[model samples]
Target: MQSQHIVNAYDQELRKLHSYIAEMGGQAEQQLREAMQAIVTRDSDLAGKVVREDGLLDELERKVEAQTIRLLALRQPVACDLREVITALKAASNLERIGDFAANVAKRSLALQQMPEIGLTRSLGPLGQTAGEMLNAVVQAYLDDDVDGALRVRDRDEDLDRAYTALFRELLTYMMETPQRITACTHLLFAAKNLERIGDHATNIAEAVCFRIRGSLPEEERQKGDETSFAVVSPGILGDGPTR
Candidate 1:
């Protein structure tokens, strides 16, 4: 009876840990969504709300850390149970970063509001949407213990990277063509980069899911499609001043 009770108690602790991860994932997703909405609508008020709410994610991460530590010290979980606890730690860390990047997007939006509106801003919507979707999908994969789903999310990150690269080139072309719009374009560039980073963190979460299930990280090197560092945008490529 005592052994059964101890087993049940251990199971309960694991469930609580899982619940913390799920809650953190949901909060991170909502933060990214709201941050994107603030950018699309140029609502400083909404941006401010996102910034204010970031503290909640921080608190949740703290709880995850505390819980994991207690489990490791008291339960001494091994094998799959050990992997589960470690993966939760990694996922919480990645989710916290996602929340941070989302907050950064919100902060950039607030800056964008002070600058002249640019047509390039519209291009960011697709990038942000892709990142948000990846995050949501990866979170679901983690919760469902779907290794295939996690792999799919990992593969989809390249798509987000490609989209970000394309947008980066466009922003560069626009800035080169119109030096006067540099400030506004710079803000947009930062905001777009933040979204790109969120995609990366989502990918990290997907990898954590794989580790929990497979007991090893992906053997193959993860692919990367971001080429912004090597991208060269010539003013002559467009053959004219930027539209709008």
Candidate 2:
């Protein structure tokens, strides 16, 4: 029957879309890991490689978008089928952003190498590790279609946020204590922020996975722990009494 053949073709196309997403997710995670390693080791070559490799994720995202558009137009998918297409689109978008952020970290690492290494640079390793772990977990959750695993990833984002906030404060204090370190610290700050953003995009992917499987987003608002905006570091606290 023609109807049965068409349905089978549509299912195959959906599987292809999922394949694209999985590939993108894997590439993005590797990018983040390499970018962090590049920073820790102060290897400009590795950082440059990460920047150049970002194009692959960009191309993959384009492929996902094209595939989803074709499926939407030809199949007129609805219900669960519609969710599959939309979730793939969303996951691809998030993965692309994660790639962009990883590339940003790599770029910052290049800049950081030109300056004197600061003590705070060491702190980024742990932060980046947490983000990389989160990304890896969420991508796995998406591939497994495990709504519970995805939810766990979502809940874990707060830990990354809190870690970032703590690092931000430490960088601020370090900058105030030694003005000469400002330039290097600023680069590290941006690099840390990029890693933090990677965590956020990973969380976005987890939420998308939840929606795809459960048909609705989590009911309660996810808690946020990033408190950088309210953080203040008084220069007076660093040295002698308060300055007039």
159-230, model 2: which lDDT tens digit per residue? 989999988877887787778878888888888889888888989889888899999988889999898878
Which candidate number would show the highest TM-score if scored against the true structure?
1
Q: What shift in Å separates residue 235 of candidate 1 from its native position after superposition? A: 1.8
Q: Tell me the spans in candidate 2 whose CA falls farther than 4 Å from its real position.
A: 236-244
lDDT of 1 at 155: 94
RMSD of each: 1.5, 3.2
Writing each residue's lDDT as its tens digit, candidate 1 over 169-206 gives 88998888789999889988999999899989989989
Candidate lDDT (C-alpha), each: 0.88, 0.86
TM-score against truth, every candidate: 0.95, 0.93
